[model samples]
Target: MGTAERINSSQRTLPYVEIMDSTLRDGEQTNGVSFLPHEKLMVARMLLHDVNVDRIEVASARVSEGEKEAVRMICRYADQIGKLDRVEVLGFVDGHLSVDWITDCGGKVINLLAKGSLKHCTHQLQKTPENHIADIKETVEYATSKGLSVNLYLEDWSNGMKDSPEYVYQLMDELSSVSTIKRFMLPDTLGVMNPLQVIEYFRKMIKRYPDIHFDFHAHNDYDLAVSNSLAAVLSGAKGLHVTVNGLGERCGNAPMASVQAILKDQFHAKTGIVEDQLNGISRLVEGYSGIAVAPNQPIVGENVFTQVAGVHADGDTKDKLYYNELIPERFGRKREYALGKNSGKANIAKNLEELGLELTPEQTKRVTQRITELGDKKEIVTQEDLPYIVSDVLKHDAPEDKVKLISYVVSTAYGLKPGANIKVEINGQQYDGSAVGDGQYDAFVKALRYIYKKYLNRTFPILANYQVSIPPGGRTDALVQTVITWHYNDGLLRTRGLDADQTEAAIKATFKMLNIVESNL
Candidate 1:
């Protein structure tokens, strides 16, 4: 039987691993990440209602008044929806201060942070094990009186397990008797534990306290957060702590998408997460956190589902031989075949199929070779570039000339704005325009736009992004490749040019864009 089937058949008996997302709380610990009160509320709603994560940690107690307001806003909305239990806030073991702060904000749950390592307990808090236990007990009792559910976070539990097992055991043994404690949360605070260590240590905790509920939280200091989280689950952890986009302090935490994928695909464990919403939430978090997700980042990254190699595309075309169980469709994404130097005829054919165009074998070979040549020059050959590339390689001249640059002059002076004068032939008529701008390229584009608007009585495409690069370790005079992306009515169009001067290269790319947009019109 499949893992899901096996787990489902024994549904009531199998352990259901609950996911607690801490993007707003721990994730905000990322350097330079601070969410406004309204942003925090919006994220909480999305995580709870849209993504359907089991729980969400929204903020820490007593951090700031802004944090208080954010927590209150999230709590108010959560209360209205009968999901108040699903929202949690991190608290400290500081008597009733954190508890009182949470209570004032209408929070129903508190994830109380306690020192797990012997060094932390002795040096950081300057308290004996007996005193620390007494403090935690007092806080739990006070929180329970306020009708708040409590979960304990054993901070630095991984290091504690390794360096001071007796103290960790003493702490757990003491806290396990508290009836108000809903879960005993263990965190690899320093991210020092590996998969094997996680399995062994987590299993030891489970065996010793078989009746206690455990939630495993991981850090990515060593890039093993996801692996350690999976190990925890396999060793009988009933809950996991996660952050969207893996945003956290230092190296961050295990990413939610990766953890979800591993749980479902590898372990057959079920979660409340809606797989399709993963990408949407990831993007949302990426924006709010100001952390750019790596293009190769698993599941939600831009290039994860894209095939860049021709052989891989050919294999996928045949029988999906290059496909993995982590299909892009599972996350509301599509598989894309990239066009570049490595793209063979099969890759060209795939792109052609998408564009609803077909070419003979000879045409295909020529187009592929041209694309390879462009790629060798470190220029990206996007699918939108295919028509121009085909026209260039096939030597199709007459129809391709919609707008052509006749002559242009650019000047720059110290402490003065750059200026440009451009002459262009559009539809076989010459138009001249001059403009001053922030830079030479900007000035050139401004002149082009002026000619299009005033002379031709037509609007031009908006320049969306412009990137320039030269081969690494090249001389100062090496060819500079400029790729310009333009937002047109149809879609985004990218055109590339190569020249010794950066401004000239950008101008060349812009000219290509004008002609392409003219042809489309």
Candidate 2:
């Protein structure tokens, strides 16, 4: 179990590593986070069916009645899908209590938690290692008698290896003989192991119990969960415990997406995960967990696939010189070229291609200059904003807007509905319309719709989606950017506007949408 042996072990073709996602159990432990029964059910379904993770630890037994109900719901769905065996619950070494709770909720697997470190066993539980082992054995025996398969979690196993190797060895030695324990999950419970230490310790465990399945559970106190996970696999660990979005108590656990990617790409290890579903499930968990995934998080992050440097975009255009094995498409995302001060012609061209627009070299230079100006002012620009940028920069050659908002006034009072009065000129004909609505924007849109429907007898486009974004720093004067999507004819159209007022930005975007629709007509 030395470095040379670890290196040699890694050189050999690695075995398929089973992935056990503990998002429901470990991830739910995040501060200020709680998942209701339905939320838990949805996340569990996505992990098992869509993401295709090998197993899911849904809950810790006896936590609460609500948790028990969530487990029941997940178990029912999993059973219907023939995935009941893949759902597991964390059970304590409390004999029949944890086991009966799980069986009553229809769970088939119990991940039995046992003390691994001498300090935890000696201080926390106030029991000798022998007493703790007996308790675990009793629990495992009871769980087996109840027809539930068992896995053992050597809690704080990393510290046990570092501080008391004999204690960990003795526990493993005693438990390895139990034919019913399907796996031994070793946790870096405090997020304290470096990669080299992980390799050293995991190799020792693998060397001692070569036949037993060892799953590495990593915490990210040192931001080394992914690295330590790789090291564990290199040291011949057979499985890994991860959580969606890396959610867990304190820092977090090894993220499912990152661990899976590294295991497959770096180690050439096989897993059952559906890579394309990784991003989707990350987003799903983010919504339900209310823990935002960092935009720069690997594989499933928002900005990981974005080409921010113009040189990278230039390289990408020429035979994909900047491409790597971590292609965005592998995770159901497409590469995006960001428009900013750093954007070069290549970046502009890449975004243009996606928008199905072609620009002359001179036009591209002007648009690039305009985007750079916006970037310098700390404004955000999206691909959907490109058309408007192009029109503004080349206004001399651009045709006049077919639909124009001459004037608008919106008012709201505490005792009454908001109202809007608008004057619009379409095709050289001016019209005035007024309407009251639930909000100022709604009233404005209704007024505009009244002009199109009553005065012109024309079908107004349906507003489909509206999103507003403000740059960071939270300054009151910070510019707001609004992007609106409209359903017009057989296709969808997007328009963007930027202004100091959010309502004004939305109105500008609405005007842009009207002009685009009118031009098409």
Candidate 1 local lDDT, 57-139, one digit each (tens)? 99999899999999999999999999999999999999999999999999999999999989899999999999999999999
Query: Count of backbone clashes for each model?
Result: 0, 0
Report the lDDT tens digits of candidate 2 across residue range 1-521. Answer: 99676665775678888999999999999998899999999999999999999999999999999999999999999999999999999999886889999999999999999999999999999999999988988888889999999999999999999999999999999999999999999999999999999989987888889899899999999999999998888878888999999999999999999998888876678899999999989988888887888889999887899999899999998999999999988998778899999998899999888767899999999999999999988777877678778989988456678888889999999999999999999889999999999989999999998998999998989986576787545466778878887876655577788789888999999988887666656
How many backbone clashes are present in model 1? Answer: 0
Identify the runs in model 2 with alpha carbons over 4 angstroms from their true place: 1-12, 397-468, 472-474, 477-480, 483-521
Candidate 2 — worst ten consecutive residues by lDDT sum? 467-476
What's the lDDT for residue 246 in model 1?
Answer: 94
For every candidate in turn, the CA RMSD to the true structure comes to 5.8, 4.9
* lDDT for each candidate structure: 0.89, 0.90
